[model samples]
Target: MRENSFEHYYTQKPSSSLETREVTIRLKNGNVYRFISPSGAFSFGKVDKASRLLVEYAEVEENDRVLDLGCGYGLIGITIKKEHPDITLFMSDINERALKYAKINARDNNITAEMRQGHLYEPWQGYEFDVILCNPPMAAGKKVWQEIVNKAPSFLPSGGKLEIVAFHNKGGSRLEKTMKEVFGNVRTTIKSGGIRVYVSLKF
Candidate 1:
């Protein structure tokens, strides 16, 4: 069974057995994060495996402005800021509770992130990101998924990267095609279990 099902993950306040659990995450690249699990982010979470994989593989440069789109509990944004220190960080989520958790997590981790509230990239209408990392909500259905692909490019500066991790079963192939149409090139950077990470540049 999927521990973090969309039904459970979609709720702003999750009342799951996994709720209130805390997990210590030590990144391979030498950052440590203590995350409050089932905090409307991941079930049984130290770090969701996909998230761990994304951070592990992607190179986070110092001073790069990053957007953690669909930030959940702010694990990704806070971790990047804490590690690099100089990188600009922004996090956004449609669920208000998710944003609340992100802020709490940031404070708990002693990291600062500009928090935005909106679906996907709506909060940053005119600005561009140096790097955007997303673990998109495929279960939000086709229209929502479509919007994510369609709008992702607008958030990037010329040559900026959009990186996404998605389950292999969740129309990830379709997403790849859509990303190519939007960004001109899309390629898989890594794959493990049923998740694949795709990176593309906007130019």
Candidate 2:
């Protein structure tokens, strides 16, 4: 299926006319976050179910270095930082507009994080993290997600983890398999509303 040009949130530069709106979300933990959403960012005004689920259930340890790959509008990373203040948070997105808003949201939320703009792991080359969380761009195509899985191991140390979320029937199963293939083990740590969060450990 060919996705419309406007729907390609994975693009480095979005062609959609830039428009801004403020979004406030109250998560299950009773924490509220504010974000500046712009046109062309994924799930612009609201956090999608899959991402919300990932934010609610993705595991992070204190003092761990974390990367939110493809972090749209900084939701996952920001929420994780709020929950685990001790963990160092890093966010990167291919979408320039999204990255810009991510920085603003971090500031609005009173969180400090290292922000970078690049495709996939490009901005973080030579850097390793204790955990990597992603709501992979399924709309971008299998190859993109495959690269995320295959290349993730090298960016993590032994016992480091990669956690990802997707709908079970809609590429989640395939992503699980790829994680297992690359990391040699995978586990479903949480599932809700047909979305599953898969965790893989680098061993």
Q: List the residue pairs that clash in candidate 1.
A: none
Candidate 1 C-alpha lDDT tens digits along 27-123: 8766678876544554345567888777767656878889998888777777778778999998998766667777888888888888987767778
Error of 1 at 129 (Å): 0.6
lDDT of 2: 0.90
Number of the top-ranking candidate, with TM-score as the measure: 2
Candidate 1: where is the Cα deviation over 4 Å? 1-4, 11-19, 38-46
Writing each residue's lDDT as its tens digit, candidate 2 over 46-124 gives: 7679988988898899899999999978988998899899999999999998999999889989999999999899999
Candidate 1 contains a number of clashing pairs equal to 0
Candidate 2 residue-wise lDDT at 195: 96
Q: What is the TM-score of each candidate against the true structure?
A: 0.87, 0.96
